[model samples]
Target chain A: MVFHYPNGRAYDYHKNENHPSLVNKVNHRSINHNRSKTIYGNRGMSLEEEINESNQYYLSQGIAVIHKKPIPIQIVSVDYPKRSAAVIKEAYFKQASTTDYNGVYKGKYLDFEAKETTNISSFPLRNFHAHQVEHMRACQKQGGICFTIVKFTKTDELFILPADLLFKYWDEQDKSRKSIPKAEIEQLGYKLNYSISPRIPFLKGVDLLIANS
Target chain B: MVFHYPNGRAYDYHKNENHPSLVNKVNHRSINHNRSKTIYGNRGMSLEEEINESNQYYLSQGIAVIHKKPIPIQIVSVDYPKRSAAVIKEAYFKQASTTDYNGVYKGKYLDFEAKETTNISSFPLRNFHAHQVEHMRACQKQGGICFTIVKFTKTDELFILPADLLFKYWDEQDKSRKSIPKAEIEQLGYKLNYSISPRIPFLKGVDLLIANS
Candidate 1:
């Protein structure tokens, strides 16, 4: 699959290109997405929506109790009719959120960010914020579980990358006009197998990673 | 010792007024002044800053970690220097955060909103959002501790109001022009006494409320 960017560069993910019908033959997983599409719908299915569904499934299965931190919106204009719901006429994006999702699982604090990249060659450093990095670093320092779920949108591949690895790549971006290469990610990152219910298969990788850590 | 508002209403928390002279005050009662200011800086602090400080304290103390969720800010303009941090040229207020603070506290999921009001007659219902109310309700239904800290700015009096009473007032606002009256807050709200550290003393109230519930 090839995606053309605004910069006019064509980036090929090369997913299922070698073997024809590979994508069609394999099933695409679906998350339990329960967020209000009417709210953030136009932005495609948001990360929060996917996580929320995943959390619900996890709760039902007695695995976890994670939830996406609500997006902070600075509502500028609102209209209140005589006797009905208040409508946000005009609102803008506020500051970047602290964590994408947080909860407890087996008496442990779970904090993480979910990001995606269409670019096949590398995951851009710009996809993350400085504060998010700082927050993750702080969490990791405090003996909490901190990681990121990186989705290769074109390949439909997800990886649970550690905060330390993220900081390393982020620091590398400072030295050059380079992103964290796919080769590097494939080496260090834990490849997440997908499924329909939770969709991300993050906890499976988490189990392996936490045990190793 | 009297602090007068624009409406000519005067309130003296009598913190200073109660101390007639240095010798008049009791030594045992005044000894608590040795506590650090940053420890309980929540008093008279903005909601955002207070949550940040509290999170820092939690992080330091190895308490239940809490943090203020960030806003998703979209910048319309920015100034890039030759070699310096980018300066925000133009940005607008984002949306209200999901909740003020959320974290693990004593093996329990804690979530709450912090608000301050200058109004003497009532705490404006406009200070909260429908989504926040709904979120709190959802958290409460799941057996989580959810509440709001309403600070009457002029009086420096803080009240920990549960979501249940808040929802009742919110529902009533549709039929009446009145907000949550101060009298009603006094009747139903738990007064969170100010302490040297974490000036809001919300946890003490949380302990009491959770025990009672």
Candidate 2:
């Protein structure tokens, strides 16, 4: 499927497969199954799909109230046909100004963005946007819990990195490397294991983050 | 403007003007100006527009990180031209499963739905969807701040009613009246005085709610 930015620039997912920053390509397939129960052992699912399933589990178990914000779209024109629903004739995807997943967790405001990389050694910093980093900074200042859920797709390994550490690397990117080495992530981040009920179960890491903070 | 629920039900705003439950009619006009500064003395603006302006003001001042979630739309088809951006050929609006506005404020998770009515006597409880109410209850149970922003359009009066009180009226609706009387809201809710920069300074009322809770 093809997507477009608000500026009318075409975003071809297939062409950007190797681009370091091309993560979370809008998965239209996952939209319809947002609240569906997790199909255990479905390793073929995208990080977004897993997160949505995990959020559904959290909601059902009364463990949290997180949700993935809908993709922002700019509709230019719509048609109202007789005896039928309105049809959006023209629309473009708008860049989101904030993180993707956020909600209340144990009375604390939780906000984070999810990213996946095929590279086994490091996670590219370019996968994150400047505006998203700025948004996380603002939320952190407000005392909200902020972090990034990084998945090494090659090994199916997941880690939750605190936003503070992300900010550290983000500010030093000009003077340092363009990515966070896997060794550094393993040293400072929390490693998550997949589960049958919630799939990713990253909130276990969030619990640790909350305890540390 | 016309919208459609996920079930293909056409929602015509002009035709539903008298529908008590039709509070927020999806103001497409406000989407583009989400981050724009408030145009002082613009009383002609809708409640949604004013709230967007207020959110912008709050964001700029580092007071809060509130935002309105994008309208959920299910895209059925898209056309990708040879060299141009993609155009949505067909799409339908999906019923939102949560409240409209949510964010972190002063280390607290804040959630709310905004509504307006021309009826001077009462604010109809039917204006809220069951899923939205259930979502709010879940958030409140998790200790997140939840409330409703009710506006009496005829008198230009606005009130911030806590979610607990809203649930009370909601539960009693089957046996009692279908609406919360204006007098009840005036007595139980916090009236918001409009401000120049934020347009609707509802956070001041939120501060009170936070303190009381």
Candidate 3:
């Protein structure tokens, strides 16, 4: 079935099935339909998917309001078809200037990025861009709660590292090792395990950060 | 000159000059370069452009970290050339599920949408969508600062209306007039005048909201 938006744009789930983002949304809906079984069984989900599910849970339960920012694309050309939606003919992906997920949590501004690495020893600093780090710093200076969620894929261990501690390693990149060691992250960061409803319960870590601050 | 992003995507300002958003950015840069004269002289600027300029000013001075979210698009297909950036062959614009702008300010979550109308007597209720209203309501419930920046293009007057007041009008749409009268806005909304540096100075209104709340 096709649904038309208020602006007259047609949205066909079947037509958009090939779109990765749309497919993810569809998969999420199916998973949500049988939460008890799929929530714990899905171990192959990406950190981003888990976070998106968690955000949905948070929103449903009135715990928080957060969303992943849409990917930025620079469109060069578009074609207005006679009887269908306008089609973008030429475009390129543009670099994002800020973190992926952000929102209001318990009246505090929350902002963070998520990353998954297969390396067992350390998470490479190259996973983050300079602009994202700078953006987080600016948000932190404005008293927002900023952090990074790093998932070690091999062990399926996830850690929430505060922006201030991330900044220390970011600043030391030029002078020292180009990565944050797993040992150090385990020592300083908050560890989170998978849960039933909100897959990645990172907000528990956020509550800790709020208490410490 | 062409600028290539770290991911090897080429960004040609000359080629993208026709794009409305990029054109706005270029005009904003020119306005920033000659803020003393152009900022006061450019009365033809759109409300979105003005808000973007204000955001840039805020970012430069470390006053806040706000941004206009990118328009979401649903990708259909792409083509990869031998030695160039991958081109999006087909895509469609997706309806946004949230407000246009959001960020952190003074440790609070700020979310808002900007609209301009030529009608001098009243601002039409149709300017906002149900999803956006619902999004704002959710954000407000989560303790975020949510509001609307409405500009009377005919009178060259602007006002920031709080989300709660907007919700009242939205809820009354079926029972009353489909628009909010100018007098009502003037009484309840915070008026804003164009100024130097941050052109729209809407944050002054935000300060009042924060204080009152």
Candidate 4:
């Protein structure tokens, strides 16, 4: 299918069989089929995919509205084909100035980043960037709920560590500290588990965090 | 200078003398030293540029954290150079799933689209898409503040029209109505004017609309 952008540019939609459209395509195993199933079903899917599915579920249930920011790209050159779609010939992915996922939940602003590691013991500090930490701090200062969703791939455990806690560990970097231990996260952060319906129900985790605070 | 993305990809920062950085380069007239004066000044710039400068102004004042969503692109292929930066070789711009701009303001979710029309009598309904109106409805359902910043280029008048009002006129399309008259907008919409420091402070208009509602 070919779709025209607001500016009248043509965009050719070619679906990859591996990743089908998530809109109303039901996979019997999973309740949600709005997005790629290849990114769901607990068969070692990426944390981002899990969260995206969770977001779809949240939207369907009127729980929350969150979306991953599209990767920023700097387009250097574009080729206007004769009687066809324009092709971007030269571009570079620009670094995002904000976190991965952001939206409004129950009238409160939400901003977060999702990361995963095979290290069962701890999440390395290197998973985060200094600018990201600063961005989160800025959001936090503005009263937005800021956090990081860390997944332990080996153990299949997920933790929503508050940005302030992550900042504490981040600032201690020069003192030779490397990672936040699982025990520390288990103690200070809210743990999120995988579910069948929503896949990764982080909003419930967020609710609990909000209630506790 | 080169800045590496959080994912370890390098982004080359090249300055175009035509448009200076909007962050902090003084223009002798605008108070903020950051960003482009061409995009900021009142000398016949696009409405999008005016809003962008206003956003930068709002950000500098700690008023809001709204940002324009980057145009989504479907990347077909990328080249990995051994010694230099990786380059996107083929890509196509994709239709956005939501509006142009969104963010958090005073803990309230803000989402909006800006449009300009040279027609002085009425703002044409063809300037909007069904999907954009649907997106606004969804955001409004979630209690997010949603509206359109319409600029009548001929008169240089700006108005913040609520999405519901837009939907009404949009639905009237089947009745053979092609546009919303200027008087209707003057009665129903909140008008905004250009200012010195912030340039296009539409948020003040938004505040009045909220207060009236």
Better of 2 and 4 by TM-score: 2
If ranked by TM-score, best first, what sequence of candidates would result? 2, 3, 4, 1
How far residue A184's Cα lies from its native spot in candidate 2, in Å, is: 1.3
What's the residue-level lDDT of B133 in candidate 3? 94
DockQ score, prediction 4: 0.28
lDDT of 2 by residue, B95-172 (tens): 778889999999999999888777898988877899899999999988899999888865778899889888989999
lDDT of 1: 0.60
Considering just chain B, what TM-score does every model have? Answer: 0.68, 0.84, 0.81, 0.79
> What lDDT is reached at residue A93 by model 4?
60
Best by TM-score: 2
DockQ winner, 1 or 4? 4
Give the better candidate number (1 or 3) by DockQ. 3
Candidate 1 global TM-score: 0.53
Give all TM-scores, in the order shown. Answer: 0.53, 0.86, 0.82, 0.79
Clashing pairs in 3: none
Candidate 3 lDDT over residue span B65-132, tens digit each: 99988877777666655565556777776777888899999998999988767698998887788888
User: Which residue ranges in model 2 land beyond 4 Å of their true spot?
Assistant: A1-42, B1-23, B26-42
Per-candidate fnat, comma-separated: 0.07, 0.62, 0.68, 0.48
In terms of lDDT, the best-performing candidate is 2
Note the Cα lDDT for every prediction shown. Answer: 0.60, 0.79, 0.77, 0.71
Chain A of candidate 1: what's the TM-score? 0.72
